[model samples]
Target: MDEVEVVVAHSQRATLRVGEVFLKVDVDPAHADVEVRAMAMVPVPTPAVLWCEPPVLAIAAVPGTALGVLGAPSPASPAAWAAAGAAIRRLHDAPLPPWPGRKLDDVAEELDRECAWLLANDVLPAEVVRRNREIAEAVLRPWTPAFIHGDLQITHVFVDDEDRVTGIIDWSEAAPGDAMFDLAILTLGHEEHLDDLLVGYGDADRDVIRAWWSLRSLTASHWLIEHGFDPDEPGCEFDVLRARMPDS
Candidate 1:
């Protein structure tokens, strides 16, 4: 019998690994549907779907280790990061998904609500929240939308020993959105690798990427806490906010 390894679990979803296969269980079947559709459409490497039955989607594990995890140093080489960036570039160049992404006004409204919640809850210093919120405003402007892995966290990217990208996982959040937003998510809390990534992704607006870092961190902190994740961990969202402080 294969031993079960719990990858992640929250009220909304959970992932478990059993040897070479991963089983993702979601509260909403629509999320699995989106993942299946998005994976099939992407130009980059992705895990193979073995089967899907409502809330449970089974996939064969891809080769290579994850690019990195939040709150920890990544052992992947600069070339590996660059390769991941190139893969992302390919995805961005692909045709937009049929569905529409969040409107800019919706994003701004959500940011406002989240910021207000952060302030009302006293999750961080008011100054930290204020500064990051100010920084977050830069990403609120309009831009050409591209197919984006909406939750392109570092852990979603995989690379092999020779510094080549192997696969990207977790497509539930994939959609049409700001390309810089995906870049920002990929480098969140690992800002040192941004230059290496840009080597493969081509030039982009660094300020907008930075703005997304702030916006994403601010909007995500509350949900992370509620989901039983610790965003305050070193090199994580809280630190990302603190680093934006003038004195830091």
Candidate 2:
């Protein structure tokens, strides 16, 4: 019998792996609903749904290894990254999902609230937080929404040995959103691959992409800490924020 492996566990949700199947248990069924719907609608490859039962969703694991992981250099070839970019482009070009994404105003409010919390808790150096906040301002403007993967972290992408993108996983955050935001998340800790990704994704606003990097890192730090994640690990969220400093 295959041993059960805890993929991830936290206050809100937990994922477990048994042999070839993964079971995701969430506190809210809505997230799983969205994930199931998004996976069904996305043009890109996704994990196959084995079954659905409210809080728990079972899915067959996709082939290939994750594209990369945060805080570490990706061993994937540039071609693999480009293929992932191409896949993302297809997703973005697809028709919009039925649901509207977070409004610009709401995003700004969250950014402000998270920044304030960071300062109040001294979670990051004042200067670091302030500078990143400034950089984050660029993303406040409106964007033509795309069918986005929303949380397209590196770990969500997978590629075969030949460097072809095989599949992407984790669709709970999927929605209509800024395409650049997804691009930014994919390359969060792997900035060196931006050029490679854009090669297949086509041109993008570099400034907006950079801004989302700051915004995402800032907003996510607090939640990561609360959820028992170390955003300060080398080459993670904290490093991404620090990179915005002039001297960094």
Candidate 3:
């Protein structure tokens, strides 16, 4: 029997790796449904769906290693980052997902709610949170939707030794939404590589990308903390929020 290694365990879901198979067990069957369908629709390389039984979805492991880890310098080459950008462009150009993602108004409302929670709990300095909220306003406007990987973190993208993107994982949040949201999430903590990623992605609104940095960091901190992860790591979520301060 293969050893079942726990990849992540949280209230909403848990992921386990048993040899070359990754099993994702989600509390929401809808999430599993979305992931399975999104993987099929995406033109880029993705893990093969082996099977799905209710809460558990089994997928073949992707080849190569992740492009980078959150809050850490990416060891991947510039070519790899460009490849990731090109892959994202392909996804965005694909047909819209069957379902829609959060509306801009909904995102703004959630940001407001989360910001209030952050302030009430003192998770972040009030001024820091406030300033970022102001900056985040830039992303609240209507966007021509695209197929977006709602959680396009650096760790989600896998690259080959030759600096080519082999696959991208975690499609639960995949839906039709702002393309810049994916771009912003991919470059979250690794702002220095924005230019390289943009070279392949082509034109993008830099301001909106920056806004998403703040919006994502603000909304994700509480969830991360609840899920047994620290958002305050030097270059992690909280730091991403702090980095937006005018004089940080």
**TM-score of each prediction:** 0.99, 0.99, 0.98
Cα-based lDDT for every prediction: 0.94, 0.94, 0.93
lDDT by residue (1-248, candidate 1, tens digit) is 99999999999999999999999999999899999999999999999999999889999999999988999998889999889889999999999999878899999999999999999999999999999999999998998999999999999999999999889999999889999999999999999999999988997899999999999999999999999999999999999999999999
Worst 10 residues of 3 by lDDT: 100-109
Clashing pairs in 1: none
State the TM-score for model 1: 0.99
Model 2 Cα displacement at 122 (Å)? 1.1
What is candidate 2's lDDT per residue for 1-248, written digit by digit as tens? 99999999999999999999999999999999999999999899999999999899999999999988999999899999999989999999999999878899999999999999999999999999999999999999989999999889999999999988888999999889999999999999899999999988998998999999999999999999999999999999999999999998
lDDT of 3 by residue, 122-236 (tens): 9989999999999999998989989998889899999999988889999999999999999999999999999999888899999999999999999998888888899998789
* Clash count in backbone of candidate 1: 0
